[model samples]
Target: MIVHFQDKTVDEQSRTSDLPIHIRSIKDFRKQKDYESSLSDRKKSKLDINKKKLKNNSSAKINKKIHKVQVYNKASDANFLFAVLETIDFNSHRPSNNYRYPQCVFRFATIIAIIAGRYAYEFLRMNLRFLLPTIQTIENNWSYQPYKEANFRFEETQTYLSSNNCQYVFVSEDCSAIIPRIEYDASLDIFNGFVTPVVEGLPTENAFRCTTIQQLKNLFETNAYANLVNIHVAQPIADSNNALVLPTTVLAAYGTDHKLTAIDILKRWLIIYKKFYSRGIRVLGFSTDGDPKFLRAMRLAANFFVRTQILNIYNNTLAFKVKIPSNWMSWFFLGSTQLFLFVQDGVHLCTKLRNRMLSKSAELTMGSYEISMEHLHDLIRSTNKLDHNLSISDLNVKDKQNFASCQKISDDKVLNLLLLNDKYRGTYNYLLILNLLITAYTEKAIALSDRIYCASIVLFYVRLWRIWLHIERSPRKNTLSEKSKNKKKDQSPHFITSNALLCIELNAHYLIYVYLLIEQNVLPQSIAESTYLFSSQPCENIFRNARALSGVYSTRINFTIMQFLKRLNKLNALTELKHFEETNTEQKIVFPVHHKIKRFMDKKQSNNNNTKLTSFNTHDLEKIILHAYEIAQNMANFVDLSNSLIKNNMFNIEQSSKIAKQLLHLNCLTESEIVDVDGSTDDEESSDDEDLDTYNKELADIMCDGDFSEDELNTSNSFENLQGTTYSGVSE
Candidate 1:
């Protein structure tokens, strides 16, 4: 609306001759100028801001967009490239004519970067102290402390023993078979105290000192008893490089010596007893095997220690004072003092019994009647040699033949055969009856019921044997001359004849003593109680252990003792841990396989056979008897030939008249050969020869004509029980 015009065209025409000038609105023109000015100012401000930003970051390198890129490679390849490039660069910088420029510099740069990184790591490690300790520092700083020595001196050991309430100490001496030559030989005298609490199953825990003669003397002289009041005497002896290993301490070993004497051994025993007695330990007994020297020593020692005293009589009807019976009055034990019993070892006694049974020279009423043991010995030897364990039925015909041919069998096997064979039925019954009594006395104290049963069996067998012997002999007396018959009719002949019979009779007396003792409700006062300790087996066990540890040819006893103690200590520790673990967890029961069973399994596997044999629980005696009975029953037809021998005052009769007919073989006896009840069989009635021949033929057929199976021929299970009887119940 507000417009203005300028006269530019007329002035331009006059001054410039034909220049055309156009007129414009002033508002529109002003707007156009302002817009242009505003645009120019904006451009200038943007340039100023970008310049300021560039100036602040002037130290940073330019970020150029690189299109040309170097090829990447492995370190090994890069190293090879760097070596090649450096060689080229070196040649290029050299003054020689053959110098050349490198085509690529990337590998050289990479090698430089690697060197820079290694240098950086080295610098960091050398400057840092709180990073890690050196190996030397660690090794020197941490280590186990040095072990200190044990505080168990001689005095401490003595004090420990004296303070404990030790009672019932037994002394045992045995020569260990370690390096058994003169100077290298060694003996040990172990002092073991009875276990506390006196439980039946608990083993002896009071392991005391094992001392030599000289050490024992030292202990006695030094008042090792701690000045106690009780007085008893004991001395232990050792010679020929003997060493003593006690639980807490090792005594000075005895040096090499010659042979040891009984007197020296006795003296050592006295000293040991005195020391133990002073320490409040009642020295109850000394046990040893029937070694000749030991026996002599014991006799001499007993005589020396024997004392006599008069005991006041009690429970007698006489008033004031009753006279002591002469039988009751003895050289020892007439006063407060008691004499230690010197009884033969039970195992030794049993061995002697076996020897007596086998000896032809043994004095007996039967006139040197000996039981042969060749078959038993051969059977044992053969059985041992078999690769597989054989069951009773598993034994082949060859094995049976071998066993039957043996002539020197063991006593138990002989007894077992006697029991099974109908020919020796009388002897079998007698042995069984006596064996039960022996078992009751040897193993454990019998109950009242068992004692009554045992007594009944014994009495029954005795009465039966006596009556049989009397009736059998009575027939001969009826046929005797009238004058002789009249003289002997009232007198009963003593029929029990064998040495075994006498021994059994003596054992019966001991059994009766045991029964009376039980009835009186008294504890066993005898030296050989109804316990395994009746044998010197415990001492023997220690000797076996020592010998095994020392080896057969060891000479240094001290070294042996040290080695033995170290092993014992380790074993004890392991035992303790095992006991602890077992108590905490449930116990696992494991039944041991019997030897026969093992053999049976081996035979079955080796032969690759599934045939079942007649099995038995051999642990049970009843099963053993049944098994043996089966074999006997199978072959009993031939037993009738085992006719009983008759006596007609055989010692006084003529040699032809004294011909005794007994079972000498497995062949049957003929009816025609049977003797009359009277002595003169020629005048008596006789059986038909044809009938006797027929009977003999039948027996022969029964013996020879048989298709015997493996089970029928097998005697392994039948005789196995006998092998266990001799030593199984003796002692460990």
Candidate 2:
């Protein structure tokens, strides 16, 4: 147990999503070194080891204790009692002809089971006949949210949001790559894969159905849709279950091209903002995977200038200690509501930085130290990869980036051998920057001071590294300022990519804004008291799980858009469960483990370490920040940042205005991106934990209303080649 002091007290409340809850394969779990190292030659099945430890009286006296069993009123308890009572007499243990099951049990079981496969679900039902509900009952009660291209069920969604008390939400829009193929939806009776048309910004609902051969021919003549742009809304509810922020999929659409321009994006964002605002729901932010177009929209949307005035209260501190860039356009407002923040996916940013390090054309350096794969290679070569977690395979450049390699390379613990020596100090500094950003984006909540300190250090070094970027005819020194570089080669040369720079700037500014929000008195208690919430990870995670839920096709990873529509709720269920694991620390979210499955008795739970907010020292890094500031300050004089990261030739004259304007009469607004904090309080229900049972019931309810639509996920021919039809197994 860890004891807390006054300065270093640890609160039991959950930190953040604390997610990245990896559901590893059995082989991967078994391969963990800790699992292998813990076992001796003598160690066999755990049954033997457990038997030695059990008291002889525990199971031997079961018969005598059977009658003493006190059955509780709960269904779980009643089922346990029934199982105990039947042990002694099989004939006497007859169940009623129509035994009613608690919907809660079916809610817990059936939805998740069916997604795995129809056959596996049947096998479980056959084994536990009395414990489960029949598939027919489930089929009659449940239904999938029908496939409507570009449909956002506004009223139904509002009812759901109101019921669940998700008032403040962050909207994340990203395109998940799918197998580009035309598919028939059995329910909608329409052919998809023809790119949905986007007018202004909104994707027109039920458009371009290939009912005739000519339309089908046209689709064949052109490239079929490759990616589904999913606009999802996420609420910050870390465990406690009461504040359940299950991602509501607003729209899943695809278009003629894989890109959306800033104007196109801004229009759609405005439409969504208006819809949520009209319903009394306050949107707090928007997040995406650092897409250039989306970043431009984010810059226009940010209301940082309005909040910048609040910094005058700390004027004595600023320019006194460090120069904080205050004009960060990373958040904005809609209607009379609050200033909405912008979040670029943290995972993507880290990957970009690593990829830049790996790029042949760029150099990453700080002072006398240069960070490259060569240093890592030297360490690996010296030990011949002896006891090394990182391999040469991790260093390869690929379009499909591997985050596991990023984690390992960024790990100070894994590279502690190199860190101890001064010769590899540049490597240590580079990893330090990587680690800080990872923590800011992915880890538990950190202190206001700590977050800023981390952001400042990370941002500073990134700028310093850019100054050292390799130029064709120049020495590897601090001389090639932005002015010295050719204007024509604006995007061609130098290390820092546009997205990376914006993210670095925005992330640093966000850290500073965390404190600003608290001071401005505009933040909800939940937002003010938490770690970073604006990440596109949830959107990414749901898509990853979409492939996982696609049973037989999982091996091939063929997730069509139709398949995604079918498993949408299941993906959300996985998200909810992930949240439960991260926050509900006392009672584990349980899944059935069969007796045949091997259990790791000694595997360390490294994930648990991430849930708690970290407290650390932030002293004595002034010289580094100063040097970084000097180079950045010099470069800023000539660099035109608006070329890539910001919008030009337009003011915030028309933002979030693509839809029919209604809420707050926002049509009359000017400088629309900037906001006033004098808006009405969020019409959010108090997150009373007393009704948390309703939370479980709601999840069950959300899942219960459906079965797979015919041809919904049919990767192969129909198995019922005889649904004409069968009862259990025998054909009728």
Candidate 3:
């Protein structure tokens, strides 16, 4: 019997002995000197020695030697090689039937083969054989229980996956057991409890039935079938499961086996096509091998969305061309697919022709459209055929010349010519033409507005005539002197001559008449209220103002100040007007004023130029008006001052008395001296002194009252006592 102790007690035996104690007194022990002196002596001795000599010495050489060295072992390399071999082995036996292995292993192996100088499975297996021995040893001895503490190492190498203790399971398989297998294992273990029994036999039918039924059930329950359809149609090679099925199906369908002929593959594809079509699903056409059967099936199943794999007929000796059935072409080629692909491909075969047609149509619609005949004439003229070809051609000489001249007309001029025609008259059409002209001008790409240059000249002259009319109606004031003494002065000879206005107007009229003659085969109506010549209200106002300034009104104002100033120096004005003169300078002076004016007037006037009555006509007119306005404003200031003096008694009869008083205050003269303002000498001195004082006082007042604040005095009494005294005579 073994005795156990819970609360059991044990008796202890004690041994008694006394030991002698030793003690030392602090006063009896003597303290030694610090070790610092010895250490300092040693350090000083070392520093005082010759460094170079010491370094060369054997002792220093021994001290400089490395203390430790890292050593490489063969075991590390062996481990690395082993890991690489294991990875290879794992990849080789990836256990496709088992779900334990990651689905990406096959993909990874394919990637490795592509990158690692291998293409086939046999090549990979051959290379991996050399590394298998080392991997087997590691795998056999690998501890599964202490997996976390496993110590394995490899050398520092780029070839192996790792150079340290990295544990990796190369191959893993599913270990699921069925009920019958589990029961059998339990019965075998019971029977062979003491002795090992080898239980080997064929698998029972029940087990097969169970597995097959479960697998079929799983296939039905999961979306694997639907996923397979999707892989075959929507995205062929995008899914892993689909990718796995694809290669097998492709090889089986196209295989050389007895059951898998080309026709057989076609039949299988047709079956799949019918199945998908019955379910209202669409199948993708085969992209790799050009299988006609697949294409036929696709066309039959979905005629509207058919895709044809074009055969390389370019290199074929026997050139083959197929005239697609009319209905087929109309259904597929002319359908949305071509349009869709055209948009997707970003290039259309018909783009150039379409653009050309569009351009021509736009031009014709805009009224700026040039006839092809005119373009042909232009081509002829550019080739220098105007002189030589006219005689050789069947066309009449005059007709050829006319054609050449018409080609010279710009696009805008052609459009304007069309616009001038009553047969093509419409406000909407005119606006459209204007918009097209503006667009052509802005783009600068098309030669749409080239002919418009001639039309622009006419427009320019029309603008000038309208501007002249405006100036003549509203005559601006001319300040020749500050006194406002001259109410009337002879108009400047330039203004009277009417050459400038006439030149602009005539140029406009000539261009318009030319356009009319070329376009309508008739001269424009009289320059009054004709359909071709309509003046806006502003133009009429300008004419009115011009006539008024021509001495028709009693206002007695100067007309066209710029013209007046220009006439003051005839040679300079004439030089400025030279650009406008169509004929010799001597001939211009001989023309009557009315004739000159008519020449300046545009032949065909449009109301568009003068939309508003007050707006300036041209840049020159605007500048002249601005300058004249500034001068008038200055004169008004002077007039305002003169008017203000009347109420202040500052410009009244007692002017001399006021001057005398101011002079006396300034101390420039005594009261008696200032009173003697009659004598020539005294009067001169007094006037001079008074003028100086008044100027100084005025300057001070201007400085003080410059801002014109309300606080400033406006009292009438301040200047009332100084009657007849001019502001200039006031003393400081």
lDDT of each: 0.30, 0.50, 0.23
Cα lDDT of model 1 by residue, 187-233, tens digit: 22332111111112111222223347785455445422111111111
- Higher lDDT: candidate 1 or 3? 1
Model 1: weakest 10-residue lDDT segment is 705-714
Per-residue lDDT over 197-298 for candidate 2, one digit per residue giving the tens place of the 0 to 100 score: 777667777665667888777767764574554545454332222332344443444433555666567657655655666576666668888987787666
Instruction: List, residue by residue over 1-732, the lDDT tens digit for candidate 3.
Output: 123342232211111112222222222232222356677788888876766567668565574443211112322323433334334446556543231222122222322322221224335545654322221222232121110000111110100112111111010000111111111112112110011111111111122112366764543443111100000111111111110111001000000111122223333333332233223222322221112332222222222221221111222211112222232221112221110000000011111111222232322211222223233344345545443242223222333213232222223444344344344322223222233223322221222122223223222322222222223322555322321232222122112112222222222222222222223322212111211111111122222322222221224333221221111122111111221122222212122245533442332122224422222122433243234323322322222322333333333213312422221122110010000011111122133432101000111111110011110111110111112211110000
lDDT of 1 at 643: 26
Q: Rank the candidates by TM-score, best first.
A: 2, 1, 3
Better-scoring candidate (TM-score), 1 or 2: 2
lDDT for residue 225 in candidate 2, whole number 0-100:
71
Q: Judge candidate 1 against the unseen true structure and give its global Cα lDDT, from 0 to 1.
A: 0.30
Task: Rank candidates, lDDT, best first.
Answer: 2, 1, 3
- Residue 51, model 3: Cα distance from true site in angstroms: 25
